[model samples]
Target: MPIPLPSLDDHDFDDLVGEARALLPVLLPEWTDHNPGDPGIVLVELLAWLTEMQLYQVDQLPQSHTLNFLRLLGGPQWSPPDTGGLDAAVRQSVAALHERHRAATADDYEYLVRTTWPEQPQAAGLPRVRRVRCVAGRNLAGTDPAAAAPAHVSVVVLPEPGGTADTHPLPTEALTTALREFLDPRRILTIRHHVVGPEYVDLVVSADLALYEDAVPTDALADARNRLREFYDPFAGGDTRDGWSFGQSVYLSEVYAVLEQSPLVDYIENVRLTRTGTDDGTDADGIALDAHQLVRLTRVDLVGYDSYGRTHPSTWELPA
Candidate 1:
């Protein structure tokens, strides 16, 4: 007969904690709890408890830190050994717990950009759009749209080739140089680069900026937008047609951005901007500009992908 695994909700966390507390004194004699609420003290107790559970479950003794204990508990890259010393088993269990927690806490952001400008009927004939995919790494990437950190920001742009324009090749060396120049400590402008391809040019960047709360200022935001405009201006100039232009703007600040049919020049448009502080005055969605009124935008329907991979309208505010 096989034993069924218990669901997380079904596990008795309180009983597990109690059993670990009872064994802690035997394992770590020097450890003391002067203040139970202390963060450090709490962490130590938690580790001690987790280690005890590992020992009980595997019927083994730990030789080192609790990491091995976790690895044995079905963590990534861990497999049950035919036989092992008590220490090895304990270490494995600890490692397994760490891996599980890490994966659960990891965050990911994804956005899709699409063509929103209506297709025009030309006498000479409309240019054929090619679809190409190019992935380039970003440099000096910040967690925010505006790269704020001195050396921690990087971005990767994926260009779709063949729909409206030819794919522009983004070289690694060019990106590194651009990052270096964009991140010049003296300049307020944070430079970000993207590669556009066959039918549409889209810029996608991401960074883990720790100082996100203090970095997003009005000046920084303006500079970031301007730099993006300059980065894509050359491509825009080459593909100028009466009704045909760059797609709508989509920016992800702090987390993600999704824009539809943005003017080639409007890099900061349709931003779902977020700030990391306690100020409620900040808007989650940045200032909205009417695409038709502000930029003579031609509304062409587009398809967008949700986090779950379902397709929907590309418009930011969908019709009721």
Candidate 2:
């Protein structure tokens, strides 16, 4: 809805004349010509008309004038996202008119993180923050059992397209620190913000695959491994290439479906899914990630077979 415009003048001509007449008794009591035809009354009406014209002119001033006034008062200016062939300054003015700087809600916080950085160059290394979940809860970190978890906002960031495995593949410390500083001013002063990665669920697949007689077993295994890796990839996982949604659970049925869809495989048999460690990781059959957690494929180990047939055995330890 559009904001309603206010009238330029507080009083109409008649009211202005009446106000002037009301002051006559105090300032000039001896002058008693109060009739509309009197020269004094005509002068008053002319002055009122000039005052009304001045007020109307003030009201008709361009919005740019108002913006200039605000700039003088130290108000921040907005630069709109570039969309070619359009006037960026005009677009920026429109966007700035609608913008609210406060981060009182989850969506608000997310918007601030995405758009409110002071410098664009510094943000190049910052991970594309995929999802943000805010909650008023206690910390559930098993390692830091006594850690306090005040009202916190957890942000999940998508990793870069290609990065080494050992180091963090997403935003570096500098980027995160910059984000922290950027968001600190906009965020609700009390709530804490945390940039965290998805809880990785390592998969150790012990599958008996029935490959086509013409297909090399090693090649088939590699193909199957690649399929699983793609299916569980953080950036391009799930049914669609888009990154997995936060809290999306991993189901064993989906894994089987991907394996069965492989063109090189005749059939998959004796497939067992097992979690790696017991710290809320993947379990047998599937994983039930929490609202702020997501499943990421950490490792893929194909056991019990070589190019010929099943030769070695692999073991998994279940959490007690």
Candidate 3:
């Protein structure tokens, strides 16, 4: 359906007369002479006619005329960016006009991956970005940019955290495809990009917990569990809470300190930390992570042997 056009005049002579009559009671209560023969009434009529003339002139102008006036002031001819507000959209469009869309450096490729693919739910799943690292060409020793390989680039990406069962796997196929498609068009001709995930080292913790007299065993255990999870969590773990930085090492002393922080914890006993997957399971003070690798906490178990010679979950007791 066609929309109705707006009225040319927002206020007319009758509206101005009504406004003046309304203000008279408040502004000049003594002067109640509002007849057409009164001088005040005649002056009001003359002023209203001038105001109506000015409004009609303004209302008669076409939209194109207003735009042309804006053009004279060096304003944009087209609509501004879709930022929901005109002032903000104008600024955004001006900034966007000066922005570069092409990726030329390693940092540019890395920056594009983060800004282009925002962390949100997709057709596959939620895209949680952990880290992005890119390097142009494989030759680290080459100082000359002209001698570098034009068709080769190594890109490593770390994905969001996973459940305890999944063991925090690498970035999924969905994320890899998204990054590739986003950068492919902007990349130089014949440029090849390799997208891969970082390597992870799996770890397991074994510790004995003793509850104090004022501490509840269940509550302490829960806190202990959460502390370990937060310590190893890729999204919100480590000292900084920004997720452990790449190649950061895990120390057994830190784990002991975390568990001991619980008010219920009297003392930790038989505390042992071990690294799996890469070598024989052995006790270690800490696990060393490579530059491209992160540590993943696989399991945390507390147990004791029963009279039946079977191992079962248990918590140590504290004497009064």
Better of 1 and 3 by TM-score: 3
**Worst window of 10 by summed lDDT in candidate 3:** 311-320
**How do the residues 178-233 of candidate 3 rate in per-residue lDDT, one tens digit apiece?**
77776788888877876767666777778877666665556667678778878787
Best-fitting candidate, scored by TM-score:
2
Q: What CA RMSD would you report for each candidate?
A: 26.0, 7.8, 12.9
Q: Candidate 3: misplaced stretches above 4 Å?
A: 1-90, 97-100, 104-106, 119-152, 158-169, 188-191, 278-285, 303-320
| lDDT per residue (tens digit) for residues 192-234 in model 2 | 7765444544555557666665776667777887788777666
Off by over 4 Å in 1: 1-61, 64-68, 73-76, 79-229, 233-320
- Using lDDT as the measure, the top candidate is 3
| Decoy 2 TM-score against native | 0.62
What C-alpha lDDT, on a 0 to 100 scale, does residue 253 get in candidate 2? 81
Clashing pairs in 2: none
Give the C-alpha miss distance for residue 169 in model 1, angstroms. Answer: 8.0
Backbone clashes per model, in order?
51, 0, 0
109: Cα error in model 1, Å: 4.5
Ranking by lDDT: 3, 2, 1
Worst 10 residues of 2 by lDDT: 311-320
